[model samples]
Target chain A: METTTLIPTGPPATRPRRSPARLVRAAAWIALAVLLAALPLYIDTAWLKAGQYMMIGAVGAIGLTLLTGQAGQLSLAHAFFLLVGATAYTVLAGPTDEERVIGLGLDPGLALMGAVLISALVGLAFAPVAGRLRGIYLGVASLSLVFLGLYFGQSLDSLTGGTSTGRTPATFELFGFPFSNGGPEIEVLGVPIRQAERIWYLFLVLTAIAFVLARGAVRGRVGRSWRAVRDNEAAATAMGVGVARAKAGAFAVSSAFAGLAGVMTVLWFDILKPDESEYGTYGINVSIAFLAMVIIGGLGSVPGAVVGALIVNGLPQALTLFSGDLGWFGETGGGGLTPILVSSFIYGAAIVVVVLFEPGGLAAIGRRLTGLFRARPREITREETS
Target chain B: MSAPTLREDLVELQVDSVTLAFGGLRALDDVSFTVEPGTVHALIGPNGAGKSSCFNVISGVYRATSGRVRFGDTELTGQRPHRLAKLGIGRAFQNTALSPHSTVLDNVMLGRHALTTGGFLSCGLRLPWTVRQERRHTERAVEICEFLGLGKVLHAPVAALSYGAAKRTDVARALAIEPTLLLLDEPAAGMNAVETAEMAATIRDLRDALGISILLVEHDMNLVMGIADRVTVLDFGKRIADGTPSEVQADPEVVKAYLGSGSEDA
Candidate 1:
């Protein structure tokens, strides 16, 4: 039984070969981090606010990517989870003085976490159906959640504050320090640290945490199972990956991320307004927008989602900011193309282009760029050795 | 429980009168066979002769319509695939089921998913415990890839591999699960003679060195006769012959089933 000849011939070592390109990538990441941290120092309050909005989109897009791109579940329930998160936070943290509405008066930070948990629970609740449905059917099925959110928002007036006049969310605070303007006044590089600047830093931290966690999950066993299920459920199951559990887990995790985005959303707007219809904030359009970010970013690419969010979500905010200076949207009523409208068109075109040119999205381009860089160094080393 | 070692104990499988049917057609009909411990067992037949359906029933991909499948003391007649895996069953597919964009290492590492505990939070948190466990599993995955002679392409996407390499990747992944019974569904389906010989050697190494019991379904007669210790032949979803390789090869029914009794007289 002892087959001496058949044992593995190569070195048993598993350590990845250290490459110069890897070092360059590490340095590039650090440079990107430093740039992000320094933005509040140079950028004005309005632009900082716009950046924060993009970060919210980044968080939502990352979650949507895990679901739609990685796990191969086409979901439009992002908006529903967002509403669930925002509503849960507001109902938990809103001041209880008003008679017409309901409030528990909890800490904002705790409320934020509660919102994520509740949204995840809502996703798990939908998982039985989610686990059964695949592809377009699942996408259409998830659309119902948006309608559910709309109806619940309008009818459950106490919690959601109806559609007309929304409820103001309590200022987000960590420990005893408010992420809002209510804390001790401070100065950073001769700039007064106000609400917008503070929110920018807060959003930066949240987005970083979300991004790091997502990257880790994507490269790990959890990610492996998701892709395995996406590729072949029978094979995955045969390898002891529970098909239903992986699907439900994706839904829950994706919802939790969307929930975090929702908390950020309410904090950014300083209010929680249930949509009057499925066309407003927290509607099908929002779901499509988040999906657009994931698709345009490249399916299953964590960093790609961020780029996608920048293009889809950042464009609108940037355009709105530039509107004062550039005067692009000069007229109000005669179909002159609003910032949001223009962004929508760009995003729609981006989705079409991504589907046509690169199904892998921006991530594939990023891979190709890195692949080129990696290949060049190898050739140079080979030439020198020869 | 810690994984059961092949050196310490041996487990045999029994398929007692397994029947699987869909609507009007019976894929497998009251067929029964046994695989003795630590042997290269082959399930072979002509097209649509219930070869894959039999493997599926045994591996729990398809529930036996009415029959018993016993792996040692465990009854796996109606069990799910994942549950069967815990009972030491790992299966590779005929179609080469591999994640197209994932690196071969990642695909192979997924085999140890059953062995790894905890979930997204444990991994996402990068908790010391989860990280350590993950590292151990990665080492195992690397070792498995090396054993399969695929160490160089560990980081390459599976989509870039040749037909034979991809099929070997499927086997490597199943091996990662450390199953007592490794089911290879047409491992040499798309391979040339040289690749088929290489696969046969790898399959034998898995049994002899790793002490894994193999159940192979193959269409290649030369490869099966060379590698398999025991051969089970099926015709029209019924067991036509089962015994030692030469014994089954010389069987009259299998001979007639294969070269056919002058075709036109059917």
Candidate 2:
């Protein structure tokens, strides 16, 4: 039954050909990275702090995008995982001699990792429920974890340090090099690299790592399985992708990312204060903010997520920075538009405009722009070669 | 379990008096068929004749109420739907269930899921072995796409493909599994005449080249009669006739099933 006639006349091998457009894109990315790396040297401490805050949002948004966007699992439990990471890191690295609180006195670097692992474990614990549900139902169910986290944060006084007085997290360090001010007296471009500058560099490195890892995952096997499960469960199963396992893995990985973001959050604020109300830090608001990042970024696109984070998280920080100079949102406390309120209105409107005009977010626009340039010449050449 | 290795083994598929009931509705009742090694076996019937149900039962989507399905030595009934791919059972859906936004190559590479190893960590890290495995599988997937005339559109999104091309992409995906038993549900359902003829030739080529048994569910009589080595006719969840294509065409019950009971004497 051997047929010798048919041969596949495919268009070249599967190895990625470096076309002009690809080379330009790669060069653009490197340029952006270099520009970002140089920002700490030029920008003042306050601006650097604002940038660090954006990096935290970037890290968290990347995690949320992977779960909600890529894996097609809606989750409001991100804030809860963030709390887990924050508390785990604090308790693990806190002074062992503190009489009122629990401490493992582990090294700060190890504690950071421990916190991520713990958060992932907590996420896996919720997987059975996550696997059985879908879409908005899963979103609502995961929201319950936020309330659980709030309750735990208040009652677990030894770990969380209670809502009345939040515990101070240990300063993060990598070996002998502290991310804080005390480790070494250093200067970059004759500017003293103090707390704000040091933290900026730390957050930048974390964000970079998170971004690269996410891009890799999104391009590889894990991503294919996620998309398969997202598109059609029956078809995914037929293709031998374990539906439950993929869902679980997505949740766990997303939680780990969220957990790292949580550690960053504590570092940013210099405290692990559980929210007093449902609207506080580690509350439903933060969860929705992250979802906004993923949605506004363009669901399932890795680079899209970073842009989403910038818009969603950067808006408020940018508004606050501008408020100091431009006298916008001049009144605070009561009956006036604060920077937070103004930024909220702006991003909320941004989300509406994005949904109505560009559902694929800024990323799809970028792709179309590139596609427009690459379509005619490249496709024709490839077809002719074939 | 050691990384789900696959080999194309030519073995008989036995559906021993399988009965599938959904509450009061009997989707499949006492249906039995054997697909011998390396042959094209077609199951054909009119609408509402349980053709899809029978496909579901074989693919482990629905468990039989009674009886068994054996692929070689393995009991296929009650097996987890995902595990069937590891046993060399590849299925292409009738409506072309694929990730629309993903590239054709990505969708086809999904069929290699069972054969590959690694999860979030290894893949995310782009580990040395995982990268190698991905490159190798991608080459194989590209070849399968080219074999099905999808070579030029490998990077095109599945949503952007034509209806016939999308249908071929579905088949290309199934072929990526290197399956010993390939299940094609209505492969030529929505194709034009030329596309249907091309699909028929592709199917014949697949059976001849790969030496694998193909169990097909189709309504296209011309295509079925033209290519199928064995034909089974089903009516109201019951097997009406099973024989060579011409023999089944001559059977009165088979004719009655296709053209309503009023035209039985036609």
In order, what lDDT does every prediction score?
Answer: 0.86, 0.88
Per-residue CA lDDT of model 2 for B1-266, tens digit only, reads: 00122224577899999999999999899999999878889999999889999999999988899999999999999899999988889999999999999989999999988889888778888999999899988888888888888777888889999999999999889888778889999999989999999999998888776777899999999999998989998889999999989999999888787776764356
Error of 2 at B39 (Å): 0.7
**Comparing chain B with the reference, what is the TM-score for each candidate?**
0.94, 0.95
Please write out the lDDT profile of model 1 over residues A53-76, one tens digit for every residue.
899999999999999888999999
Off by over 4 Å in 1: A1-10, A16-19, A375-386, B1-6, B262-266
Error of 1 at B182 (Å): 0.8
**Which 10 successive residues of model 2 chain A have the least lDDT summed?**
A1-10
Candidate closest to the true structure, highest lDDT: 2
Clashing residue pairs found in predicted model 1: none
- For model 2, how does the per-residue alpha-carbon lDDT over A65-87 read when each residue is reduced to its tens digit? 89988899999999999999999
Model 2 spans with C-alpha error above 4 angstroms = A1-12, A375-381, B1-8, B262-266
Error in Å for residue A134 of model 2: 0.9
Where does model 2 sit among the CAPRI classes?
Answer: medium
Model 1 chain B worst lDDT window (10 residues): B1-10
